[model samples]
Target: MSPQPHEKRQTLAHRLLEVRLQGRAAVLKGHHNTNYVLRIGLPLAVVLGVMPFVRFKYRVPLKTVEVVPRIWRSEVDVLAVVCRHLREVPRGFAVQGDRSLHRYRRGIVLSEQNPHGPVDENMLREFAAFFVRTAKVPVKELPAPPRDWPVDGESAKFLHWLIEFTERRVHLPNRERFGDLFDQVGIPADAMAAFKERHLSLVSRRFVLLHTDVHRANVVVRRKGITVIDWELAIYGDPLHDLATHIVRMGYSPTERRQMVDLWERAMQAADLGPLTAGLHDDLDTYVDFEYAQSVYPDVMRAALGLPTEAGDEHFRVAAERVWSAMDRARGPLELKSVKDVDQIMEALRKWHSMDAVSAETTVV
Candidate 1:
């Protein structure tokens, strides 16, 4: 009898491991995974029934999140649905242990290609097209959402859930460890509550698949077109949330941002997805504001945690600048009383660094 699907996965996984152990795999560092790329040729190539030189990406998950859900768990299931309908997405292969494998597309990443500022009109339209395609994916086909995920078209409730997730899972859990730093850096503990109060109402629109993290780094510019990778953060929710995240993460200039929004609306209308574009003008900014507001916690925490053990003035300066930038973007949305200047932020970092070092030493002893 032919080997079952799981058996085939195991066999392919074993072969990939042998290659990785032999040091034939090229390594790339990612925030959540250590990716090893291998050009699987010969008998293994036949296993996928493709060409001899098909490359594959092998990912080993890092213990990056304390309480946040393992992204790959949702990512694998989401990809199964997306790959069935879209060809630009990478085909998820299998998972073994905490590691997984998928087809690796060869091309320059959009970030590397553009490097800075806005993309051209052609690229922008392609982005809109991709978004429309993603929106058309039937909700029933998606894997079950998390407990208490807002029902479809409940935009206000959806935004509330996201804020609660950030506050509850991302912020509150780390408050003990990072609270002092947050206070010193001018971020009030009540920032989220204030945001919730200010943006209490949002216009309802149909929920669709949202690639909540569609930055330039996650997009590969291929000969055929641009292929968006990294489905790890995909979620079902307000479509505007996807656009808002894309706009902020892509760092589009004011004119380009406006143009992109127009393109998106036009594309959605043409595709007969007008219901998804409901309240495009009135409520889009709310989603954009929410993106900025939620990002501050992670950005500040990461900057502080990124400091080297023996970090110097230069290292502190970099971390402080990162924190300052995140806060500057979020200040309005979060309704902060004040934002710390770089020097003030640096001082806060210094204090946190000292405390962290002491904590580490105590734990070791």
Candidate 2:
């Protein structure tokens, strides 16, 4: 007979307690995708709580179950399953295929969680390789898109609306608020307008299965391998969106970021996909720009989550400054000298110390 609700609850409680008690110094750490480090006597089992956007949990008995989930809403489940699958493979062969699989799973999960966090560069490269490989797999043999999904037009419209809604509330400051900085840094009104237009245009492209969010926090590094957690935003859209999200969230230096692009190009080549085509590059660029813009959301969300107002304000100011700096760099050479000249035009945004100083030193031509 099936267990009663009360019995099931009791069983769950007992299992969790047992795992906690038996586990040694295991702490749950993750802002988005919660996880538990389980020490089963000798072997360590990292039980990940996947799905940052939804509520669900799973405990796999073995390390080689199916990676894809039975339900559509359970991307975390699929990720956990994939991690377990990679872990079970023997060492030699596993080193190659399993490593790629593990990184791919972890990258997807991390992308779903907070984007700004520490990441293992090597693992990310491996995952990038795997992403290109999997995407190139014959479409006919791939799994079907989710049921009743909106077409690209509807999806693009929905995302555009979200961007607009978020933009309207730009006045609000949060832990990572940066809109104010954007306005101060001379990001021309035209540039912002063009960015929005480009985003809208790109969203209408052919959709592929994409992990809409790729960030650092959702990925976990263990002795065995990396594990990816969340998958709620998995959708049909441009694959480049996933790559761009990963690149932006990794927070690599400009040089490192360029290297990542090169790595992606290499992976594409290895997968027998043609050289980095212009169309593909443009798609990737569009996604990267959008990801950079959306990066402000985290600080905003952090403030919403009750971080101190001062801290949130600082974050917002800094992010805005960074955006402005990037925009200025994109424009022509810098030209401003003396504090008087700088202060007369752009307010002395204390948060942007370097830019402010530079502006003060240069004379506008």
Best by TM-score: 1
TM-score per model over all chains: 0.93, 0.51
Tens digits of per-residue lDDT for model 1 on 177-237? 8899988888778877888888888888988988888888889998888889978778889
Shift in Å, residue 82, candidate 1: 0.6
The regions of model 1 sitting more than 4 angstroms off are 1-8, 11-15, 41-52, 66-72
- lDDT accuracy of residue 321 in candidate 1: 98
| Residue 257 displacement (Å), model 1 | 0.6
lDDT per residue (tens digit) for residues 1-365 in model 2: 99776445445444543554563533444443233333232211222222222211322222321211222344433344333334421111111111101122222344444355454568657667556644553443334555644454354553454355345433233213344444444433333345567566543444445555455665655455554444544555456666776776667667667777777777766766643333666666655665555443443233222323244445445544544444333442122221122332124244444443445568463
- Once model 2 is optimally superposed onto the true structure by TM-score, how far is the C-alpha of residue 158 displaced, in angstroms? 9.4
Cα lDDT of candidate 1 equals 0.84
